[model samples]
Target: MTSSAVDPVRLAGERRRIFLALFSALAIALHALEFLLPSPVPWFRLGFANIFALLALFLYDGRAAWSVNMVRIVVASLFLGTFFSPRFFLSLSGGILATLAMTTSRKLGCEKIGPVGVSVLGACGHSVGQLLCAWWLIVRHDGVWFLLPPLLLIALVTGIINGFVADALLQRLRRHPPFEDIADGAHSDV
Candidate 1:
């Protein structure tokens, strides 16, 4: 094929891959940075890495969001030497639940709720998923239930903070050509 005659399918696939790589890198960096910080409580993460997943959900589609999330989880785990470990599974489950919740809310015409609301929902989902994972694998008792209220509160605060950050990022990105293209619905399949 001529250089100018790029296949549309191939072009779309390439774009998706490139975007996924970029998003994954951002997530991995954020995850690493967060890991370096000392937390007062064990198993407590600010979840800043998820902002990129949320960005993908809004900029692309559910598939793209999930792709970004999974790539981030796997690659970050590998980098941190946590791959296939219990911690890896916990992170994976929480990330999956959060991405699913946010993407589903977006796809269901919940735009009125905006990113903030979606983020809170995703945060709640993430907390619940992680708690469930802990309950099953570590706690193995009803005592784990006691952590829910506090965890949910933390999630809400972090979600709002992250949501504002994502919203700001999206506002600026929307002015750019690629994001504008997506906003114009040109990448409906994305």
Candidate 2:
């Protein structure tokens, strides 16, 4: 073999990090892009970035999903100049709760629910988390929760959208042998 010939075995071993990095970057880009889109509600987002969190959850596990969420929040906040601000806290809380919801739903209903179901739950969780945090941090009033109805409606809509997207991508990825191996934890030494 040539001096620089690549080794398939070694590449397989590094797929975890490579996949993590890929998902994180895609999420971060989506997050930053979403910032520029106008929202019907103030501080409300379409949550395009969360699709990758679902991807990470399905492809690996909760830890990978959490990592993607955290990286997307911190890095995207830095890029958008919202780091260490109230907005940052909102994103952080939402991301954490979303990941938790995705993983829990996946674990409890793996045989019953697919990626779409988990993604919807994650989106709902994210909305709830952000709403509660916003109330606690900014509104500081009991009446702030009145927004829950509309917010949840929006969450459901967006969640379904994101869920479908994630499902389609997951279906395609699952058919690929390398990704199947990665998802199955068949790759060693990562």
Top TM-score: which candidate number?
Answer: 1
In model 2, the runs with Cα more than 4 Å from the true position are 1-13, 182-190
Across 89-179, the per-residue lDDT of candidate 1 in tens digits comes to 8888888889888887877754565778878889988998888888898779989889999999999999998898988988888887545
Candidate of highest lDDT: 2
Candidate 2 lDDT, 1-190, residue by residue in tens? 2223778667654776798899999999999988878876786888989999888887777778888999999999999999999999998888888888988888778658777788788888988888889988988898878888887888888899998998888889888766855544221222
User: How good is model 2 by TM-score?
Assistant: 0.88
- Alpha carbon lDDT of each predicted model: 0.81, 0.82
Measured with C-alpha atoms, the lDDT of residue 133 in candidate 2 is: 92
Reference-based lDDT, residue 55, model 2:
83
Positional deviation of residue 33's Cα in model 1 after best superposition, in angstroms: 1.3
Judge candidate 1 at residue 101 and give its lDDT: 88
